[model samples]
Target: MATSFNEQFDQHGAWRREFSLRLKLLAEWLKDHDLLDAAVAERLRRLEIQVRSDKLMVAFVAEFSRGKSEMINAIFFAGYGRRIMPATAGRTTMCPTEMGYDPEVPACLRLLPIETRLQPQALMEWRMVPEKWTRVDLDVNNPQQLAQAFERVSETRKVTQEEAHALGFWHPETPEDNPVSDAQGMVEVPRWRHALINIAHPLLKQGLVILDTPGLNAIGAEPELTVSLIPQAQAVVFILGADTGVTKSDLSIWREHLLPESDQEDIRLVVLNKIDTLWDALSTPEQIQSQIDRQKASTADILEISPSRVIAISAQKGLVAKVTKDAALLEQSCLRQLEDALGHGMLDQRQKILGSAMARGVSHLRCETERVIQMRKRDLTEQAIELKGLHGKNVSVIRHMRSRIAQEQSEFDQGGSKIHAVRSVHLKLLREVFALLGSKALKAEMAELTQALGQKGLKLGIKRSYSDTFDKLRSHWTRVQGLIGEIQSMLTAMFRQLNAEYGFALQVPDQPDMGACLAEMEEVQRSHLQYLSLGNTFKLAQPEFAERLVRALSTRLRGIHESALGDVELWSKSAAAQLDVQLRERRQSFVRRMDAIDRIQQAAGGLDERVQAIDQQIAHLDQLEEKLASLAERLVSAGDTVAAAQEPLSA
Candidate 1:
């Protein structure tokens, strides 16, 4: 039996909750030990939020009537005993629908007006302004009513050809390629540009977001669907009709929407859906099997992925099997296999990505704390060793020891001048970095690109201008990365000087990689480049829509820029905090040593007792160090349920 998506999602939720608890424990430990200052506390809060809100998004992209919606209904909503999403024979789910649960909001259906596309703001920006959406309350207890309410997503409006053309739904030059006007000069357009469904479904509640995308025409109409949403999904299940094989439209959707590399490591699955269409009574079981194999192999060859990556399944049959509780049909449908693939593939991939990121931050925090603890341990040991020698010493000898200690203190304090200089340079370098990555620079670049694109004409010309916007941001990142390198280099030299002078033993901070951010910027460019090819070139070729598209694309680029800034900002703060922590530790160590000497000077009654106390303190820190190490190890490795680098595309 395949592992239930519900069961797997629950497992992920359980794992996530446990991880959160551990993070909380780590935070508390840092607080209790006085390792968490305001900055550290803020970072901890962000980490917790990241863990809580992390979702495994799966995009089901395909041509019309490829069983994309049916696959979703079968894999997730079968327990409703009927299809929640209307998955009939024709083009249903006209708009791109996102299915997820947000308990903070009421259970409802929120639909963005199709007219919102006329505005310069993107769908992503529109999400923040809830008032723009048409809200319908969902009654989970009344499934029939809820299903009917959802049917609005597939509803279409008869728009005049001029209106449809303006919305990029009608193309007069390429009428055969997209939706065309009827004899009455009216074109059918999706009533809503996008749909947001919030439900109390178990899988959705556990942060599994299901993206049910419409066909290429709808995808082309809404550039954000292809540009931002689909590319960001943890996995994309490219559904194809098994009977139809790779149709022209299907191939177009694949190559166009998906920026597939030649390597099969991309987080995607090829599901040859509607295999039931191939089940002919005249054909033997062996013959049917042979037909399925050939199709899968042929799809793999054409798509240039490994053959094992292509999964053949009857989604229609799967839904029937699930709704009717027919085990044999369900097994034959291979819905369970797809479920297993998604569970093992997407969920686990999300875990690793999220876990690794969390681990980097938490580990850095732990290491800083551990360094302070080690310093405390070393101080105690030195104190104990000095006290042992002091047991039999006379007043003159004690005076000499105090003199040496005072001289050391004087030298350490004298380095304060050096500290001020290094700190001044550090602040200046940080200022330069922040200025380079400032929101002002980002806005200026976007505005410049938008103006340039708005002046352009033709699909190819406009696409180049759109791509130039991303390249501009990439250049910004490259510049920021160089500035960060300079910052890191300066900090390393300053820290090494301090380590030699005051014994901070600071490890030089690594410059955060802009590669990931740059790559994502490149991806947005590629997806939007395809967005131009959807035969909606005439629409985009318009100066107003062209400018609007660039402005909308700005939302995505802004996010990328902010993320890169945050990473660098965090590193800078961590680096400075490490120095402050060491300085504080050193000052405290001096105070304690002076107090011990004063006590011994006052009266030499219990020298052995003081020595023993210092030893015990050192021993306690040794135990604490072990615990801290264990905690960091567990935080990183906990819920590493996924194995390393499995052939993800394989069945």
Candidate 2:
């Protein structure tokens, strides 16, 4: 199981390097030819970072004692010949644990204090601050020491009900949902808010992120998990215990968290774990198989997913099979099926996402360069034609052509002033768009809403805050959309005027799609409303939780603001880049024409030589184009080969 995913990932990474190499080749060529602009260079650098730092986020979500940790151990840490995560018995993972490799960070486990949950700041913000976490250096050579270090994730502390309630764990209204209190009236809660483990594991190095989420209590307390983390993961694995089947809590977790949006694909895998528990010695093997099949079908019907998405696997047996090298038990465990599904789904889906993003950026950069080079080629052909037409003509013909070229240069210089005026207006308008959508703008809006909402009742405050905030945000969206339209309209007019007057074929760039960003804002609002509907009732009533929820949701909305700003900036710049490339190419063409005529006038019959010189430049551009085509082909084909082998995959 490890080998298959590892092989696919290694192949993916190798070819990804090839993609980077091709980009480097094109970038160096552009730099050498002085065709690279700020936009193109920035895009090239972004693609480089993306290719080098791509990670597939595969989240394992399940209720407690669903063998999630065991499944992870079987699939990822089986090579260790022992359990890497604390999967000994009931609910070993007390908090959310993420495992991955980072060369920049040393091999260690970092735990954020559970006490930090009292703060309004989110886990994401805390993650950026090193001093806030308790870091434990891992001794990889010693597996026992490593396992002991992992135990910290499951560590718990006794806290009073008041403290737990303040930490957003205990609920007075839902006493059944609260943790059991001891004789001293103290509840057991996770000592840490989150765990981040950095290991030198090969799969982690291959860019596989393993997210191990705890049961309902821990997950419900973390708003970031639902609002950001889980949805963003490339693949999700929802495990269920064969012993308990889909218990009420399990159903709650599934319906509330794992359930997909209507438009979203139902890609999450439902693993019927602990299947070995169903093995009946008195019954025949066929009877046992019948029982397992029935369980799987029943689970599928209940979850409203196809039966094919549910895989019956014994994580404990699989782990043992792997450690003991028992092929028969390993096959019976059926971990391979789940592994293949997860491996292909995560790696391939992530590959497509990475490919599409890079393709957009790379294509934009390449096309811009191609446009400049193509224009040069066309100008070269014209220069050759102009020179060749002077076969038997006198010096007066050459002088007339030179004067016309000079006039054309002056016309272009005058057009430059118009281009500058448009660029100036575009930038001024872009600043207006940014002002409404920037982080500071979002913060200011949130602060005012927070202050105003505080005066209302808890329920009213929650509803009104979300309604008012999103309403104002949508207004900002409308304004940004209008400004973006104005910018695009202005640029479109500029492109058309330039083409009509200068005989250029400049296409107007499409308007920036602020729709996707706006939809993200809508998603956050929907989830917040859903959270309210799903009965975070008591949690919302509390001032701390109310404030935390606001801050968490606000953070996401603020991110969208900043993202919109950058995106609008990039789109506006892209349009300007196209114009700049064409204008420079046009100016160079006039220079080449004037130079060709100057050479002819200086010599007694050098028209043929001058035409030959122009022909050489045309041939050079042909080679340049061939090289670009070859590089582009290599970049696309690098993933195409690997992608063809990837069939339907899941997690």
lDDT (Cα, tens digit) per residue for candidate 1, span 313-411: 999899999889898998999888888998878777677777877888777677677777887887788888888988789988888888888888888
Report the number of backbone clashes for model 2. Answer: 1
Best by TM-score: 2
lDDT values for all models: 0.80, 0.80
Clashing pairs in 1: none
Q: Report RMSD for candidate 1.
A: 4.2
Alpha-carbon shift of residue 442 in model 1 (angstroms): 1.8
- Clashing residue pairs found in predicted model 2: 341-650
Least accurate 10 contiguous residues by lDDT in model 1: 642-651
